[model samples]
Target: MTGGAMDVLPAAPAAAAAEPEADEEADPPAAAALTLSPADSPPAPQVSEPRAPDSSRMQMPPGNPLLLSLTLQELLARDAVQVELIPEKKGLFLKHVEYEVSSQRFKSCVYRRYNDFVVFHEMLLQKFPYRMVPALPPKRMLGADREFIEARRRALKRFINLVARHPPFSEDVVLKLFLSFSGPDVQNKLKESAQCVGDEFMNCKLAARAKDFLPADIQTQFAISRELIRNIYNSFHKLRDRAERMVSRAIDNAADLLVFGKELSALGSDTTPLPSWATLNSSTWGSLKQALKGLSVEFALLADKAAQQGKQEENDVVEKLNLFLDLLQSYKDLCERHEKGVLHKHQRALHKYSLMKRQMTSAAAQNREPECVEQLESRIVEENVIQTMELRNYFSLYCLHQETQLVHVYLPLTSHILRAFVSSQIQGHKEMSKVWNDLQPKLQCLFAGPHGAPSPPRSPQDGLSPH
Candidate 1:
């Protein structure tokens, strides 16, 4: 990742890398290419041979690791790259909210429309059907305002950053072309690259040997973590909504204060024809009118302060909450995929294998012709291949381990968010208290200057300062 394209992704064996358009993993090693002199190579994993089912313990046929050996830090890609999304209105009438996705990991800037994100997400789901693929932000056609566009941009940014940081997805031809290819038909290129590519189990390489690295109580741990993350997501989601509502109220209050100030100023400026009540107490009225006019300045200033504080709350609290929630959502998706997607497929494969085994046994026991028994045997072999792939996927706790580790690695973000939230709250309360403290003396000076002694002069450094 530190180097340019060549350095980030090593070329696969030359034969596999021949097509500039084809993915490195698109074409499996040709039969002839794998056919070396018996003395030149050691025996390969005998995947074609059948083995008895052993339900007592998890196991996989020994095979070469599918993926290159890399440290956890390398896989996380924490400091390796930066993903930036600059949004611009590209349509002639501002109908299109286009995003320019730029990354040091890719060759150049790629402008992606929301539709492009849609296609890219679909490809991810298709390629890694059982893996946790985060959902894209909902698309809308009629409402593309600056606010909506900015929110969607943030969502899309999170989506791409997560994908870019992932070791497998980072080097994936789908992602590489989506980010780098300068061609007009990027959607087509994405679709093409997704074809012929194997699933995550094939790419992960360590999936078959997951039991060797994972703990014995891996299932229990995954369940517990998933439950914990769900609780956090639910709680934080409510917190974010409340924070947003609080900011909205601040904005509304600011607008109301401005209106109040204007009305008060109008009352003070009415010298055209004094009302009967005003004339009855002309001396009192005249001075009171002057104070009323001056009230506008104080109210307007307070309104501005409220508006500024509202923006601070949004950045400090709501944004941070959103970030943490996004991570939680992804983890939840992983939990769901493991149970409903991968587990279900694995069960179905088992059922199919059992059915084929029964068919072969029945045919052989009936004293059937050799051709019939051979045909039944061949069908059972085909079913065996399906079982192997499914078994690898079912036991692939390695991906789960990486994802769980990723959650812990990024969990510190929540603490940073909470710190910022508290700091903003403290700052906001201090500002409000200062406003009331400063206003009391100003009111005494304006309304009681003649009748009562003027308030003691304030010091130069009377304003707020951190203790």
Candidate 2:
């Protein structure tokens, strides 16, 4: 019944019965022939052309899709960012550490100092006011020991990776410049790039209209998710500290084992060779003395094994835990930013607008000056800036909800991290079991019979009576 293209669809004889017979035409001689409309009008254009019939009208789509179909979750899953940080010596005395960054995102390697990272962090804060740009690690610690240096490097690497891997930040010009630019004036360059904060509405299409775009329960979902994540962060932060202490204890145990064996060797080497505790009867005491002398060597090997285990735990468990903590910590930072940064500015804008409204109203009522009132009216733009502030507030909330959802999406990483932890534990325990096995034969040799021949292994059945 519709006019334009459906009329030409009638030309297809196979499907013509689906359409009502046209008023303008009688039955034609052959059913396969084309049909035309009434005499008053020319035949409708072949609007429903056959496949491969035409090539002239091929064209690109009109514009970007009206809806936001791009998802942060899918983008994160598909895109990969590989970044490596190798800290090198810097400053005249070689007292400073500068990171040599090799970035897959840039396909380039650049040398950046702590100052460079600081500048870049400042720029990111300005550029993406609503995004969760994690805070940078402290610039310096009380003592710049090897542990501190390595920890600092890891923190900086993690922070950068978090920023780079984020979908919105991946396209940022500020990020691109900081990563790829190797100029002497990198500081100035970063400042110029992020000189002004961006307009929130321009960045988020439905920022001003979030009521229509976002879900009805999105606000409640955000609050619940944030609180859950916060609780997780608090619990896991303590857990991370406990994990660090566990690793430290392992390292300390390794060191203590080394010292313990050495101390035993020193005691055995004392000039007072046969103390009362030795219970030497002069005949068999020589063999016992010899065993004591070589005991340090056996124990030293065990200590070395302990040290290796400590290293394994550090890499596999503690590092993975730290990686997850970094993500949680960044979300924590984003939540704080929502309150202190965006909301604070929005409130200030409102306060300023109110003050201006009062000033303008009072000036007009008192008839203080026509020029003054006109100036106030022009600058105020009839509550124009307030409208922008309102939009930005809504936009900030929109981004906050989206970022919270992003955090939830990444929650599955905990499983992978835990799997790695269990594997490392298995490997570490197996290695220590091997060390114990090596010690068993050495113990038998130390207590060997008179000719220094090693004692044969004793079975558990030999110790029990079988009746």
Quote model 1's TM-score.
Answer: 0.71
lDDT of 2 by residue, 203-243 (tens): 44444465444444444454456447656766777867877
Which 10-residue window in model 2 sums to the lowest lDDT? 9-18
Clashes of 1: 1
Model-by-model lDDT, in order? 0.60, 0.59
Quality of model 2 by C-alpha lDDT: 0.59
Off by over 4 Å in 2: 1-94, 141-143, 195-208, 264-283, 292-298, 344-382, 448-467
The sequence of per-residue lDDT tens digits that candidate 1 reaches over residues 163-194 is 77665566567777777877887888899876
- Find the 10 residues in a row with the least total lDDT in model 1: 9-18
Measured against the true structure, the TM-scores of the candidates, in listed sequence, are 0.71, 0.70
